[model samples]
Target: MMGRTIFIDPGRCIGCQACVSACRECDSHRGKSMIHLDYPDEGRSVASLPTVCMHCEDPVAPCAEVCPADAILVTPDGVVQQADTTRCIGCANCVNACPFGVPKIDLQAKLQMKCNLCYDRTAYGLAPMCATVCPTGALFYGTVEELRAERPGVQVADSFTFGTTTVSTGVAMVVPADKVQWPVPGGLPVVEINGKDVR
Candidate 1:
């Protein structure tokens, strides 16, 4: 099977929040949006970057590694899932361990919540809700070849470096054609968009 995954193109984002709205409609999200948009420069630019679970691959999942409750699950296909509510103890370990800063502690539910790439839909061979509704194709769900064919000038990068630690992820980011590995200054976990960094 050709591997299908989400590819994020920060440059293509229009701050429309369509992806966020679509994420909220997913049944697993329970009416809450797992995706969020980050404005790299709030006062200067209209450019936005959508944040989703990177689903770290190398070193496995840091969130799951630190979970004493073993609540975080990584699918065979390598998607790092949200905490299992029944097993989660609301410890916030996963939230703190995630380098991408994707996990959130739901106050009311007392559970860690994050994007699972809409596994419920992807498992059935459907595009994720966010990708389906993105007008600009900023969030795309497809094979690597498809992405490369569509955007030949962009580099599909899945490896990021934070100080001395490097992480490989299931999801990829579309960056400048010349760049491949993303390096975070001062070991901070932030995504870069058009040369500006944001979390």
Candidate 2:
């Protein structure tokens, strides 16, 4: 059973960086989390993926399998967290194994860390702080099946309204369009107008 996969709709990220603060709000994700922003885009309202540990379906746990210390452990909810402290030699092997680059070595703490996904909040049926703090209602949370079910035929997005306008004026844009195509990359919605994939 997949607990809840954290969904990142880049069209919703305004580059506000508020989620960074949200990660630090509680002890769950407070200490040197693996979650991080990457390679800032030059375009206004540039889209960025908050990359972190995307727990895989494979049997060989990538990070844990690579770790000599056996530092990574997969939780019941599918969140992989640090498991072994005594065995950790801080070789940074697991850090490199993560494809999303979700593991970080806390130089201060001298251990690897990443986002715990606010285990405490999710236990009570509350949204994670980052999703809650998202001003644009973009960083949403829910079961994958539920989220996929919620928008089956919902028109995804309208082409004329959000399609060209936001891209035209230049984007200090709040709530960036998913993309110009009805489905850009993440299988989300975007509108294609004229020559541009105006999102």
Candidate 3:
């Protein structure tokens, strides 16, 4: 459904970058990927987090609020469109304003690039490329209610406080259980990779 929201379950991510690759297939972004795969801490563990535009629901998104040229637009469905090429001045205000760090300024094109949630596909009742190709079900395509029903232990939060203002987003983040205890020592268990033990 066009109204369906995206859910990200960081626990299920495997650092494969399939979502990142699929994002590049969107026609709107062409060869550039709007999704970013991040390793919050490499030394602690190998877990990864795939981040897309949170599609903030603030009446005036931080990016749009900071854009001097008014190039960024938030649609009725809460999808944040890429900055208009004609109006965008390659200024990094949008990039700096985003709390999730989703927006990027294209130096060559002089425009801001960010995930539009595969509008072309979602508008047609199709899944976004990233959600479609995610093997771990980390990048989910469903409603907030559905995600909550299926994952009772995880809390879904759409609003976050950045400094003084609170920003609401269309996308929901699946928060892991508080004070989660891992069975393995130091979070990651020593495992054998090939013929040697990896610790």
Question: Residue 199 of candidate 2: its Cα lDDT?
Answer: 67
Top candidate (TM-score): 1
- Ordered from best to worst TM-score, the candidate numbers read 1, 3, 2
lDDT of 1 by residue, 68-168 (tens): 99999888989888899899989899888888778889767788889999989998999999999999999989998888788776678888787578788
Best lDDT goes to which candidate?
Answer: 1
CA lDDT of each candidate? Answer: 0.84, 0.55, 0.79
Off by over 4 Å in 2: 1-3, 29-33, 43-45, 145-199
Question: Would you estimate the TM-scores of all the predictions?
Answer: 0.89, 0.66, 0.82
Q: Model 3, range 21-47, lDDT digits (tens) per residue? A: 889999998889999898977878998
| CA lDDT, candidate 3, residue 138 | 91
Q: Where does candidate 1 clash, by residue pair?
A: none
Cα deviation of 75, candidate 2, in Å: 1.6
Which residue pairs come into collision in candidate 2?
34-114, 180-191, 180-192, 181-190
Better of 2 and 3 by lDDT: 3
Instruction: Please give me the total number of clashing residue pairs in predicted model 3.
Output: 0
